[model samples]
Target: MNSIISEGVQVSVETFYQPDYSNPVQSEFMFAYRITLENHNAFPVKLHRRNWQIFDSNGSHREVEGEGVVGVQPTIQPGESYQYVSGCNLRTEMGKMKGTYQMENLNNKQMFTVDIPSFEMIVPMKNN
Candidate 1:
């Protein structure tokens, strides 16, 4: 259970590798992930953008920045939890990613970051 606190919001992740759909010998891996964002603050907030630093097993690192995950910026109230499932592709069979969500506190004119905990992605060998 990897969780990080960003602007009072706790974000955690669980990754599932799709080895049946990957070609590890060719350095192609597929993984699906579920991220949970819990607003443990007393105020409400909305996720605006994504900023991440991803490091692959091959010593390659990439920075991905984007707005509105899955094309929607949903507002989550206080004590609420938001979850989304997404997928990503990597050139290696394993890697680690950590990032923060740019969030806006609707209650006040303040913007804060919600930390995303470092999570691992691994494509387990498919059993015959």
Candidate 2:
């Protein structure tokens, strides 16, 4: 798991390699990641957008940017948290991902960016 705190928001990530969904012969690897966003500020926050940078060990790279996560913009209350699961496909056995979330302070309607700590996804056997 990887974690970071930015702008009073805590972002943590845990990655899982989905062997069942991966085709080693085809050079396709699938990974699922769970992200937890915790609001440490005194005010509530609403997730507005997300931007991701994905890299594969094969020298492949991509950027993903869009509104919300998993199709919904979540609102996290002060001292509360929101969790979501998302998937990514890589051309290699190892890869890393990092991103940022654009969030709005519900109390003041101010926008801020929170860093999502970098996390790695690797086929279990590849770790050795």
Candidate 3:
């Protein structure tokens, strides 16, 4: 797991390779990642959008931008957290992902960007 704190918000990530969904013979690899967002500010924050940068060992890259995470904008209160699991498909067995979340402070309507720590996705066997 990897974690980072940005603008009073903490983002943690854990990644796993899904062998069942991957077809190495065809150069397709699937990975699932769990992200935990923690609000440390005194006010509540609502996630508005998400932007991700994905990289594969084969020199392939993808950028994904969308409204909210997993299809919903979640409000997280101080000392509270929101967690979700999402998947990514890559052309290689090794890859990485990093991104940011656009959040708004419900109390003051202040918008800020929260960094989602970069994490690696590698087949378990590759760790050796």
Worst 10 residues of 2 by lDDT: 11-20
Clashing pairs in 3: none
Cα lDDT tens digits for candidate 1, 1-128: 68877678888899998777788688888888899889989988999999889888889999999997778897989999999988778898788888888899999958887788989887665322
Candidate 3 clash figure, as a count: 0
Q: What are the lDDT scores of the predictions, listed in order?
A: 0.85, 0.95, 0.95
Ranking by lDDT: 2, 3, 1
Give me candidate 1's TM-score against the actual structure: 0.91
Off by over 4 Å in 2: none
Candidate 2, 33-84: lDDT as tens digits: 9999999999999999999999999888999999999999999999999999
Q: Is candidate 2 or candidate 3 better by lDDT?
A: 2
Per-model tally of clashing residue pairs: 2, 0, 0
Model 1 lowest lDDT segment of ten: 119-128
Each model's Cα RMSD:
2.4, 0.6, 0.6
Q: Write the per-residue lDDT of candidate 3 for residues 10-122, one digit (tens) a residue.
A: 99999988999999999999999999999999999999999999999988899999999998999999999999999999998899999999999999998999999989999
10 residues in a row with least lDDT, candidate 3: 118-127
The residue pairs that clash in candidate 2, if any, are none
